[model samples]
Target: MIILAATPIGNLGDASRRLVEALETARVVAAEDTRVAQRLMQALGVENRPRLIALHDHNEREKSADLVELAREDDLLVLSDAGMPTVSDPGFHLVSAAIEAGVTVTAIPGPSAVLTALAVSGLPTDRFTFEGFLPRKAGERASALGSLADERRTMVFFESPNRLADSLRAMGHAFGGSRLVVVCRELTKLHEEVRRGTPEALAAWADDGVRGEIVVVVAGAVPRTVDLDTAVQEVLLLTATESLKDASASVAAATGLSRRTLYEAALRARTR
Candidate 1:
């Protein structure tokens, strides 16, 4: 059997009973960081010393098969530095390998920074997305955020402290300064803080130097209420008074639809 354990995100108290029991009896432990695993064991008062193996993003794929081989006979435990394994952390490859090798894989569910932040974000969470981390480069980040400008589901992203201010600023430009957002920092810890406001306001707050791990939750775009046929008619009405290009651009800008798409629709309208 292959057991995936979720360690505490920050607070040690959040560790589950099954996770401790798993750790105490396991023969081999594949950890993201061996030192962190040692620390967790100490904190949990777990005396059993399982043979710790480092399985991180840099080497998870490479080591998956070997770990699965060991699990064929004895139980092999998996853990990430925080939260559940394979959640923007390493463990996915191992899970897949275990399945292929006919090994039973299960999880000891516990703390999660993603769900925790989203629950307290004050945004509609019925439908949402977890965009692990944004690109480090400015252009890539802008392009990524711009692509999601029309996304109706709430979005979540993980970001480094140093880049938090810049990311929020870019989001303000892409999703707009008025878009609702919450910056969750050091969650489940003493310094835990959740700041809610527009991206612009949050960006300004980040300027004071935010610290620790950060999770950003942003409300999805509320598309214009205009339907497709109505939007096409509006384009036609504008084209009667202006050039097709100008009309399409104006309608597209107002409706938050693609300008080229609107232009093509306008041409079809002329034919029809």
Candidate 2:
């Protein structure tokens, strides 16, 4: 059996009783950071220390097969430095291997910075997407942001403290300066802070520098209505140069309008 356990993002007190039990009872424990796991066990006053092995990003692939084999005979506990395993963590590979091998998999749910940040972001949480981290290079980051410029669901991203300013600047350029965003820093820790403002304002503030773990939530693009007559004329123009299907897709992508609506408009334009 493979048990994917949740570790505290910051506060050790957030560790659940089930998580503590799993940590103490597991025959084998795979952790992102063995040292951190040791410290956590010691703090929790756990007596029996399971055989611990490092299972970070670099070693996950090489070690997953061995771990899954071990899980076949005994309970294996998988944990990350923080939050749930397999979520922006190195546990996905191991989980996949275990499932393919028909091993029983379970989880000990606990605190998560992603949920914590989203709940307090003051942004619409009815629908959202978690973008784990952005590309480090400036050009790659901007290109990534450009693709999401019209995303209507709130977007979440995890970022390193050193790159927060650069990421915010890129967001401002892609999503517009007036777009709303919230930066949650050192979440669930002693110095937890939430800064909310336009991307431009946040970028300016971050220029002075910030620190600690960061989670950013940005508002999605607001949908705008285009004139029906204008949309029909545009679709007609596009169809002259492309197929009806291609024309409708192009119009929808360009105007942020529904593909169905654009196709209907195109049909009406063709008839007229």
Candidate 3:
């Protein structure tokens, strides 16, 4: 069996009993950072030191097959430097390989920056999407933000401290300056803070600089009168080059308008 264990994101007390047992008994442990894993084991008083292997982003693909092979013979524990494996972490490839090799795969669910931020974000969490991180380059980041301009569900994103300002600025341009947003910084730590405001407001605050691991949450675009008309026009434009269904989907994504409404509007426009 292949176990993907969830380690504490910050506080060591967050580690579960099952996680402790897994760390103590597993024959092999694949960690993103061997030293960090060792520190965690020391804190938890788990004396058994399993053979640790580094499985970070650069070496994940190359080392997946080897780890999967070991799982076939003995229990192998996969962990990231923090949080659950395969969540913007290093365990995805290994988990995929283990599954394909007919090995049983399970997780010791625990602390998650995504969920932790979402819970305290004060944004609607009923429907939300996790966009792991934005691109490092300005153009690529702006393009990525633009692609999500009309996303209706609350959006969650992770970003480095240095890029927070630039990211907020791009979000303001793409999603509108007044878009509701919350920046969760250093969560579960002493200086943990949640700043709530419009994207523009947050951008200004971030201009002075911010630090620590950050998770950003932005409310979805609200439909407006002009936006409805624009949606009608977009649907007509796409319908001119594609099928009605495809056109409706595209317009709905671009305008935050209901697909059924856009499709009905398209039919009426076509008849006229």
Best by TM-score: 3
Residue range 46-98, candidate 3, lDDT tens digits: 99989999999999999999888888899889989889999988988888888
* Clash pairs, model 3 backbone: none
Listed in order, each prediction's TM-score against the native is 0.85, 0.90, 0.92
User: In what order do the candidates fall by TM-score, top score first?
Assistant: 3, 2, 1
Itemize residue pairs with steric clashes in candidate 2.
none
lDDT against the true structure, per candidate, is 0.91, 0.89, 0.89
Say which candidate scores most in lDDT: 1
Q: After TM-score superposition, what is the CA distance of residue 31 in candidate 1 from its true location, in Å?
A: 0.2
Ten-residue segment with the worst summed lDDT in candidate 1?
249-258
Candidate 1 on 1-272: residue-level lDDT in tens? 88889999999999999999988888899999999999999999999999999999999889999999999889889999999999999999999989988999988899999999999888998999999999999999999998788677899999999999999999999988889989999999999999999877888889998899899999988868787778888898988789999888777766788879888987898898
Model 3 Cα shift for residue 81 (angstroms): 0.9
Q: Once model 1 is optimally superposed onto the true structure by TM-score, how far is the C-alpha of residue 115 displaced, in angstroms? A: 0.4
